[model samples]
Target: MCDKNCSFDLSKRHLLKLSAGAVAFAAVGGLPSVSYAASLTKEERDAMTPDQVIKSLLDGNQRFIKGEGVEHDYLAQQRTSQQGQYPSAVILSCIDSRAPAEIVLDAGIGELFNSRVAGNVSNSDILGSMEFATAVAGAKVIMVMGHTKCGAVQGAIANVEMGNLTSLLDKIKSAVGKTKFDGERTPENYAFVDAVAKTNVQLTLDEIRKNSETIRDLETKGTIKLVGVMYDISNGKVELL
Candidate 1:
């Protein structure tokens, strides 16, 4: 019959005993010790330059391509980031099931601020979100990521019009006109689709700089960066454009 205080002490003692046993087992070479990296703290995120942040993401992608991604303890990260998050980059990528931004970039929880749409197109709402992510939340980079064999790019190229999706695809039509592909300019031609997707990424980045004075000012001051990227679905590689 233990009192409440005694029960608490016993629980603490039990945890300490388990921890000691685990450490001892590792010390004796009976078990391998594993430690997961924690989520980025405010100081760490603030200390990094914009280019450094982008390089880190690219390196992570390399690791992912090598099938050597870091094993994150997500529960620990979740608990550590319960109070706040300080992501260094905001990524605008396609909503394709095959191109998950975090997994492709080998990012863990609280490492990136990600926004996804069908064609990676941006509107006022997305602009506002970017403003919040950068101006308010202290993100240092804005990356627009497009992928090969995109259905949205195909739809936009085909002038697809269905219900509300018509207006969304209409926004991407400008890139179709801007793309200069010598080969067959059709959705069935995957090369043409990829070219249009690249053009769309560049156009979207240009639109971001043109539309958002806050982001443009940040870029002008060298406080942040605007980047364009294309992902290859066949090879799991990202090209920095």
Candidate 2:
């Protein structure tokens, strides 16, 4: 058996060389040997295509919804990632306590870069962060995810005018108008609220593409993928939109 330092070096080299085929196989449930708990290395992240990254996330969600998520070794992951992280995707999600992006997607540490905000809205800072995540850090996918029963979506629908929140909710108001709903368009109405939230995700995607030419060009060139998704808290399912 190798000594401590030798083992550590071996682990680092092994992690760094993790194959793309292993990740792709894991995405489709074709491999059980692939460890989701391992920190993603640059080689592993670089090997995945944008579509594969999205598919892997979806597969993770499937595991989550089924309550079959892989048991992670947090300490091992921490040790593995202490050197560096090479995440494949950057996700923008809500600040809601129940909708944490990593848990819902069954992703371990170092697998994703999460940027959360109220209503999953994008501003200059969030956009800048995403640009950095993709352009600088080599992430291949950007996902804007919104959830059902979001209070921000409710506030926008009700026109709640609190101090700073009023301005933040105002950003989502346009989605309220854009959402075609026949039922009661009130925060109390869960269906309408969810509809607005979904529209908000799409709007945020559009805004990011329009406001950030860097991201738009990367997407146009197929270097990265931009997607929108909705998380259903009631059912623990994430659906791509």
Predicted structure with the largest TM-score when compared to the true one? 2
Least accurate stretch of 10 residues (summed lDDT) in model 1?
7-16
Q: Residue 149 of model 1: what lDDT? A: 98
Cα error of candidate 2 at position 42, Å: 0.6
Model 1 lDDT on a 0 to 1 scale = 0.82
Candidate 2 lDDT tens digits, 171-206: 999999999999998899999999999999999999
lDDT of 2 at 7: 12
Deviation in Å, model 1, residue 121 alpha carbon = 0.6
Residue pairs in collision within model 1: none
The per-prediction CA RMSD against the true structure, in angstroms, equals 12.1, 7.6
